[model samples]
Target chain A: MSERLAVLKTYKLFIGGTFPRSESGRVYQVTDAKGGWLANAPLASRKDARDAVVAARKAFGGWSGATAYLRGQVLYRVAEMLEGRRGQFTAEVAAGSGLSKAKAAAEVDAAIDRWVWYAGWSDKVAQVAGGANPVAGPYFNLSTPEPTGVVAVLAPRESAFLGLVSVLAPAIVTGNTVVLVASESAPLPALSLAEVLATSDVPGGVVNVLSGRAAELGAPLAAHRDVNAIDLSGADAELARELEVAAADNLKRVLRPRPGTSWTADPGPERMLALLETKTVWHPTGSLGASGSAY
Target chain B: MPSSPPQSASAASPLADVTASDAALRRFLHGLPGVDAVGLEARAAALGTRSIKTTAKAYAIDLAISMIDLTTLEGADTPGKVRALSAKGVTPDPTDRGTPPVAALCVYPDMVAEARAAVAGSGVKVASVATAFPAGRAALPVRLADTRDAVAAGADEIDMVIDRGAFLAGRYLEVYEQIRAVRDVCGTARLKVIFETGELSTYDNIRRVSWLAMLAGADFVKTSTGKVAVNATPANTLLLMEAVRDFRRETGRQVGVKPAGGIRTSKDAVKYLVMVNETLGADWLSARWFRFGASSLLNDLLMQRQKLRTGNYSGPDYVTVD
Candidate 1:
């Protein structure tokens, strides 16, 4: 008897916490290293990108307003789910990048660990960034860091699993909602990661993953006036330049890509800090007990 | 048991003569037409894609501002809260004095007097939500009294909710008579009937309810009470707009439409305006014909308006809390 046929999965874009085919009904065939057909990734249109930004914007209020401790717990839960699905990630990473099974497994483990690293940073980011300031006047001065609302990210194609986690973990850990364009060629792993995120208690629209050409999806997102910031760590020089210019329409906070930047290196707090805005508040400090300087 | 009563002799009420009997009303409604849900939703979504940008966007923002029925229907509402909402309504963007006052201030019956006093000389009409507001679970006598109290309290406009239980239970005549009775008690006040379409559960029912309200002498047919889980959606609003357009075509008299609840953005408000523009034409684009039943939506519009004028994005703190 012939061996049972493997049922191939159809990958859809994750937008607004639901899996929907592109409104344009366009999809591109994705293949493995040996050119074996893997899945059909949705060729998301400009409208799809705008829709994702809308979703991310809608989710910003709730996700950003959530208690820091709750966000930390939810991010940690993502790591737990990713660890449970380690073997699946390993297979996809291997099939997507033509890596050895052992190497792919290591990448998956590292990706899961990256989530854990950022999960712990969620609550600490506020304390590390916010503090009282000494002013000469009779006023209490303090500055607090706030999330810069909705962000659009172009995920690196080279390190689909690790690099995707590297960019996504920090943006969301700091309370900003994200609309990310997945690696154009090796999008299967990113699509699979969306499933993990959906089950990991990550709010829908909090992190939307679109699998398509980077420029097509990224252009609209960059130009979207509602999008507050953008990360171009994955784009090539030409596309990155174009996106950065388009992002200027709304004066979006941009993180430009540089050559030879390693995704495997330890990501610093800069990734989290880059997406936050400092808001300084001043309140008049009255004389303590009717006596000037009671102490 | 359907009652076949004698037809009244006046043309003042077109529905009064046609719907003389319960069976006649049922036949008239069910035979009005079947609603194509997909077609309605697709049309609404398509209209929403209109890019009212730059110069056109500025005009739409102001137009939307003037067309808003700045509303507060909270159970926890107080006199002070209503007064604040009224002040915000009269001058939405206090910093930008060029900003126009909203079309009206909508509140509950009890707060109608306070809202009226708050917006006294601003030319901002006071609208009161009556007939037990979000729910029409009260008796006919009580509901009529509720409408009378608001009208007596100087409410220029009365927003009354239809009894969904009666309409859903095939009590067409009862629903029609109730609206007529409320209209009678409203005296000179314009009657805006709330269908609470979410509870009705189907586009066909929304269409029927809209016509039922209009035929029974409603000055405007409102979408929701701003209290239902699902209120004033684009698809439902579009369906109601189409009904008013068709109603005018069939009967020479024109009616207005107000969609309340869940519309909390300048963009959503503009989309509804686009729907009104295309579906009902420019005639319904004014405050006289169309209005948004929203509170937070006004501030967002103000913020967007400020952005357009100043060329910088503004935050919530820049706008008033109301």
Candidate 2:
């Protein structure tokens, strides 16, 4: 047992496919249910946030511009990988969220299903929600909803795995870049999920997962003008309100806190649609009145 | 026994007997204390000072407006107008015999048949405002009956207005009961409950009503009846979208949001769309969750689509569908 303990591996932050310690080089210990030290989570800083934003902005164009069908395929790959590692997630979630093994397994299953759900939505959303407009004028008009570029996510605290997946999958599926702040106390599973995303065809920087206190990191992300939206799911009431006000600086889209519920609840279409932008373009129809009409 | 016709008993009430007089309702509404207490001067001043930037996102902007009134299509020429709008995808200028059709055509119990027949095979869906639309002032039985009748008549979706009078009068349980009753009658049909934000009268009320509707099994929580003066605006839409998003987080039941009334142009539609996307994200961008309710909005969107597809900008008259 001592020899096995000696062989325990170290974890690092995943940024743009490369693992690095916090630029701050700070490490914090995360514990299991029995008060035993499980692993060290990177104590991410403002510099890390800036680095993530840079990575996300760099990756935005390629990921968001990818055809919806291709995006869906990449998401499906992530789901497949997650499915392969189901036991790992179940163990980690049980440790992190302090749930029973059976409950943890169910959550892991739901999280994987969530990934597949959003992946399927990538290609079909546009056809279902947008289309050519029938205008009163001779104009080629169309209203298609597009991704709102880079987004910053605050994963829910209680159900770390599913919450993180819920926010990340939707943000990336529609082509927007994401910087996710995993639950501070329960960061291991989030880091592990990142490993799955890394192995999947998900483009680096499309999702940058950081493990740290949401209070320390969330404000900067919410207030960051470059961050188009903030999902304040993990934050407390005070934090949620503060982020809401801070988000107003840029009129950033702020998804307020839903009290008394974890992220494992039924995430219907409403969650996905909340983070999209509809662009309706109008063009002049070049036609003269009755020019070809008979006398 | 089969449930006695829903809302059947409530037909005996004075409110039910009140004639469908738009003018009388307008007058009564105008006479409300708050309606006149806030002067147009103060309102104008308030409006000028507030520069509300539109938040464009996936979830916030998907608005589904419930149109229960078909006055715009009521005439000897209405069927022709409906047919023309359905066939050509354009209408003459309102001042010049052309009023653009809305994102959808919302009709009532009887009119669902006409709207469905007219809009069939067209991309437009035939939405019927059901479960005691506008007032929802009837009994639960009658409201459910109304919903059943509309769905039976082929309403693709049902938009039921909550009992605002009950809600404002502190009858939350009653409001919940009524919405649940209507929801029960919906069966497989989609249910959208109008909050009548103007009647709710404040952001707090709007938020509260939003939650109440979601709690009572509303598929979509909507913002107003265009008949009201204070119609759907960016601020109201923002508040409602936040509620919907929060509700999703809590119940895991993602309720759709619709901002009906006063949305009449492509710009207006885009602004609302931007709000949804920026607030909710990409998950709610589909027509399944989002829609616009305007009598004249779709034509503008169509015209914009045409322009995007073709480099040329065609006049409304020249851009006939057929």
Best candidate, lDDT: 1
Per-residue CA lDDT of model 1 for B1-322, tens digit only, reads: 1111233356565455557888988877886667777887888899999878899999999999998999988889999999999999988888899998999999989999999899999999999999887788999999999999999999999999999999999999999999999999999999999999889988888878887888899999999888869989999998888888877866778999999999999899999988988989998889999989998999899988987886544555578776
> Largest TM-score belongs to which candidate?
1
Q: Estimate, for each residue in B1-322, the C-alpha lDDT of model 2 and write its tens digit.
A: 1111122235334223212343432332232222222342343234334323333211122232222122232324355555655444323223223233334566666677766787676455666776666767788788788888888988767888888888787666677667777888788878888888888866556666676677678888778766688887767776677777866764467887777778765556666666666768878776667766555555444544443333223234334432
Assess candidate 2 and give its TM-score to the true structure: 0.47
Task: Evaluate candidate 2 and give its CAPRI docking class based on DockQ.
Answer: incorrect
Per-candidate RMSD vs. true structure?
6.1, 23.8
Q: Cα deviation of A198 in candidate 2 (Å)?
A: 1.1
For each of the candidates, give the backbone clash count: 0, 73
Instruction: Mark the regions of model 1 whose C-alpha exceeds 4 Å error after superposition.
Output: A31-38, A65-73, A98-106, A126-146, A249-251, A278-287, A291-295, B1-68, B76-103, B109-125, B130-155, B161-188, B195-216, B228-252, B257-292, B295-322
lDDT of each: 0.88, 0.71
Q: Which runs of model 2 end up more than 4 angstroms from their true locations?
A: A1-5, A284-286, A289-295, B1-322
List native contact recovery per candidate, as a fraction of 1.
0.00, 0.00
Q: Write the per-residue lDDT of candidate 2 for residues A120-185, one digit (tens) a residue.
A: 999888876688989998688998878887788888887778888887888888888888899888
lDDT by residue (A1-295, candidate 1, tens digit) is 9999988788999999999999899999888889998889999998788778778888999999998899999999999988889999999999988999999999999888888999999888878999999999878899989999998999988998999999999999989999999999899888888898899898999999998999888877776777889999879999999989988876899999978888888988999999999999998877765567743
